[model samples]
Structure formats: C-alpha cells, structure tokens
Target: MPKPNPANLFHDLPDKLAAELVNILVETPSIRIERIVSTGQCSDAGFWYDQEESEWVIVLKGRAQLCFADGTPPKTLCPGDHVTIPAHQKHRIDWTSASEPTVWLAVFFSA
Candidate 1:
C-alpha cells in the first residue's frame, strides 16, 4: 500500500482585501512543508512570530512593506522579494494594498 498525493490547489479571495491560504505542511519534529498565502491590505505591526523558530518568507506576487522593531525604515517588497525572520526578532507588516494581491510562501522551522 502507498499514500496518496493530492493535486495542486488554487484559492481566490472574495473581497479586494483578503487572504487565501493555499497550503500547509505539517510533518512535525523538523522542517514543515510550506505555507502559501495570498493577501491584500496586510500589515506587519509591533509583534513577532517564531519565538522558538525561524521563518523564511518570499513574495510571489504584488508588493508589501516589512517593518522592523529596531527603528529601521520599512522595506518595500514586490514579486520575488524574500526575507527571513530570525527567532525572537520582533516585526510586522508595515502595509499592503488591494490594487494588487500580494502572495507569499513561508517556511517555518525550529533549530
């Protein structure tokens, strides 16, 4: 016997501002599969993720702004933009827009 593999899926948002989660992998104990997110009017605020893990993220479409807690100016990102949030690094989504949908692929894992 063997496990079945599902086909690729696509998700569309209803409003001009929305987030569609394409997929999520959960194997546990090691690196997870991946998370595909589509967003509009998203923002990174004054909090943080991955307190016990690290995150690798990339922009697949549209644009966004990444705000850091170190007083650094927000960084603009578009298609093909990538960033890694280190463990315990506080950050947020500075801004996003509805004109264009922002797509992101994120990988999270602990070390």
Candidate 2:
C-alpha cells in the first residue's frame, strides 16, 4: 500500500463555527485520537463531561481553561501544556481564547 499522507495540526483551521470542532484523527478498538479546534467556546453552566475512557490532552496553540466538578482548581493551559484526566472524572472547558482558535490534541484510551 502507498504511504499515508501526513497532516499539519496547525494548518487548515475551520471557519465559521456554530460550535467547537472535533475531528477524529485516528481510532482503534482501544484508543482514539482527536484534533479539536475552539473559537471562544465554553461549556454550559452546571454541565460537565463524564467520559468512560481516560484522556490525555494537550494544547497545541492559543489558550484555554479546564475545570473539574470535584472542586479541583481550574487549570489554565497555553501552548504545550498537557493534562491527564481519569475516567469518570467530571470536567468541562471553562474558556477558550477569543483572540485566536485554540487547537487541542486529545488522546482517549481504555484503562
């Protein structure tokens, strides 16, 4: 088979978002990789994300704030910042930079 073409994570950002963009870059039975682009979007108040799989996420560009429902302090992420969230941990994106599109690389896997 021919070699697969590679992609740049920082290029070709989506325009005119009705919501945050979530693009699955790779997937398997046990793992999934995603590229997420956010333009000043935040989760709704009193809402939280509870995922079955563990997640490791990194900020590739711009900035964002993440908060957990368990009273943990919110985290501010800039370029190159990363965090690991365990399964069933309630969390949400509190804020994303309005000045530019925030790019995130997230990996989800079964533990």
Candidate 3:
C-alpha cells in the first residue's frame, strides 16, 4: 500500500476571483468530497440546486446564507457551521462575505 496523501484544507487558496473555485479532494463510486472557495458569490435569482445526491456542507471560514425554495428563513452559516441537505432539496446560496474568501467543505453521498 502507498502512503496516504496529506494535505491542508486551507492551502493553495486562490488570489484572484472570477468565479467560485471548486476542487475535488476525493471521489469514489458512492461519495465525493470537495473544497469550495467563494468570494462574494451567490446563486442567480429564481435558481436552485436540485442534486441527486445528499450533501453535508460546512463553512470552514467566513460566512454565508442558504435559502430554500419553501419560504423558510434563510439559514446563516458562520465559520464552523454546517448543514445537511437532502437529495433533490431546492436550495441556493443567497449570500457570502465579500471581504474574505468563504471556504467550504462539501461531501456528497448517495441517499
């Protein structure tokens, strides 16, 4: 067996921001892990994410707001906050802190 690869989650952050940067840290048949860096990014109006896989996401740095299509109050996520979104749930990023890059760790898995 080979030695397991080691990495720091906060390493290699992007300096310029044209779009959200997504890096896949791990992928297998049943699960995928990604690191997302967002600097003042949000979903377009009337748009939502309808994913086939369930997702568990955590904010590693900065802050964000997640809104659902059901009219519930948007969930505010600060650093160290996390939420699990069920498959097919209509959700979108409403806002993110612009002064600093918001770092997120997202894990997607089969339901």
Candidate 4:
C-alpha cells in the first residue's frame, strides 16, 4: 500500500463557485469525512436534509447558519463552532458567508 499523504484543508479552493464544493477526504464502511466549502449558499426553500447517519460538523473558516425542523431559533456557527446532529434529524442550511468561503469539516458515522 502507498504511504499516507498530507493535505491542507484550505488549499486549492475554487475561485468562482456556482455551488458548494464538497470533497470526500476519507471513508470507511461505517464512517465518512468531508471538506465542504460554501460561499453564500443555502438549502433550497422548503427543503430539509434527512440523513441516516449521525453527523458532527465544524466550521473551519467564515460563518454559517443552520435551522432545524423543530422551530428552534437558527444557530450561527463561526470558525470554531461545531454541532452534532443525530440521525434522521431534519436540518437545513439557512445561510453562509457571502464575503468569504465558509469551510466546513463534517464527519458522518453510524450511531
């Protein structure tokens, strides 16, 4: 097998983004890790993400907002803020920074 390599999370970002760029950095049978870069992006209106795996995500740069189906106030996440969403929880991206790219590291795993 080849030796492991190193990658910079912030390197080689897109210049003009029509949509969020998602890169799967690692994957296993029960787990997946992704690096997502969003620029002024949000979920489609009336849309919600219902995933079978639990997710833990952290913003690495810029900012983002998330809204849940339970009617709680939207949550704003900054560079270091993180959240854990259980499987089947309905959530949506309410907003992302328009001035800069919002880098997110998301880990999805089986409960």
Candidate 5:
C-alpha cells in the first residue's frame, strides 16, 4: 500500500453538538485522530487524560480559547495555531465559536 499523505487526508466534518470525524487512524491502538472538533462553550467539563499519553493539537480553521485548569487565563487559538499538551497536564476547552466551525487536528500518542 502507498503511504498516507497528510494533506490528502484533511477534511471538514459535519457540525453537531458531539460531532467528530476521525478521518485517519480512528481505530488505531495507542493513537487517535480527531478532525473538525467544535469544542463549544463550557468551562466545567474536562478530562484527566492519562499522564502517559501526550496530545498534539492544531487549529486548522476558526478560533478557540484553551486554558489549563490551574487558574491561568485562556489562550486564544486561531487558524494555524498549535499546542502540545504534556503527558501530565489537565486542560479544558474554555471556549469555542458557534458562529463558524472551529476545525482542529488532534493526535494522541503514548509517551
């Protein structure tokens, strides 16, 4: 089989409250692929992901605000923004716009 091209795999998914399309590696073990995530607006829910796993996120379109659960001011994320979540850091999606789709790329890998 030919190698997968990251550019060719990119896509925008439908907009829904819990809509998330895994265009790539959806069922692969030890890794995950999430595209076009509409994080929405809520500050009370967050995940205490396993510390042995690290996440790399990129904002492909629209905007959002991400804040670690340590009383830090939210950081604005726009198109082309990228951030890496450490293995042990607990974070949350502080806010995201409903006016426009906030497309994001997330790759999770074990440390």
Candidate 6:
C-alpha cells in the first residue's frame, strides 16, 4: 500500500471541486483519522450520518455548519473550532464555505 499522506494538509487542492474529498491519514483496528476537504459541499437532502463509532472533529481552516437530528440550530465552525459527536448520534453537513476549501481533521473510534 502507498504509505505517505501529503506533507501538508493545505497543498494540492484543485481550484474547483465537484465534491468533497476525504483521505484517510491513519487507521487501526479501533480508530481512524481522516483529512477532509469541503468546497461548497453539503450532505444530500435528508441524508444523515449515523455511524457506530464516536467522532471528534476539528475545523482546521475555512468554515462549515453541522446539523444534528435533535432539531437544534446548526452549529457553525470556523478555524480552531471543534466538536465531538457520540456514537450513533445522527448528523449532517449543512453548509461549507464556497470561496475556499474547508479543511477538517476527524478522528473516529469505537466507544
């Protein structure tokens, strides 16, 4: 398997993105880390991510919004912002910055 992730998270991004890009940075039996780049991407209508693993995510650049199934207002995240979603908690991406790519670091692990 290829061993290297990019040396920099902000490098090699295309000027226009047709969809969000996700790259696995690390993976083990119980944990996975990902680098996600979103350019004006949102979850498909009525789609929610309901994963069995807990997720802790941080916004490394740009901005985005997360919507939960509990009907609370979407939470906006900018650089330096972070949140943890417990296992099985339904959520979806509501918005992302269109003018720039939003970089996110996500760690998922079995709880």
Candidate 2: stretches off by over 4 Å: 1-6
Candidate 1 lDDT score at position 58 = 82
Global CA lDDT computed for model 6: 0.92
RMSD of each: 5.4, 3.8, 4.2, 4.1, 5.2, 4.1
Q: Write the per-residue lDDT of candidate 1 for residues 12-91, one digit (tens) a residue.
A: 53335344454665557767656455456554344544357787888877678877776767778887888877877767
lDDT, candidate 3, at 69: 84
Q: Please give each candidate's TM-score.
A: 0.69, 0.91, 0.90, 0.92, 0.68, 0.91
Report how far off residue 33 is in candidate 6 (Å): 0.5
lDDT tens readout by residue for model 2, 1-111: 965444878777865477999999999999999999999999999899999999999999989999999999999999999999999999999999988999999999997
At residue 109, candidate 5 shows an lDDT of: 82
Position 51, candidate 5: lDDT: 53
Quote the lDDT for 45 in model 1. 45
Q: Give the Cα-based TM-score of candidate 6 against the true structure.
A: 0.91
Report lDDT (Cα) of residue 20, candidate 1. 49
Q: Per-residue lDDT of 1-111 in model 6, one digit per residue for the tens?
A: 965555788878755689989999999999999999999999999999999999999999899999999887789999999999999889999999999889999999998
Residue 5 of model 6 has an lDDT of 58
| CA displacement after TM-score superposition, residue 4 of candidate 3 (Å) | 18
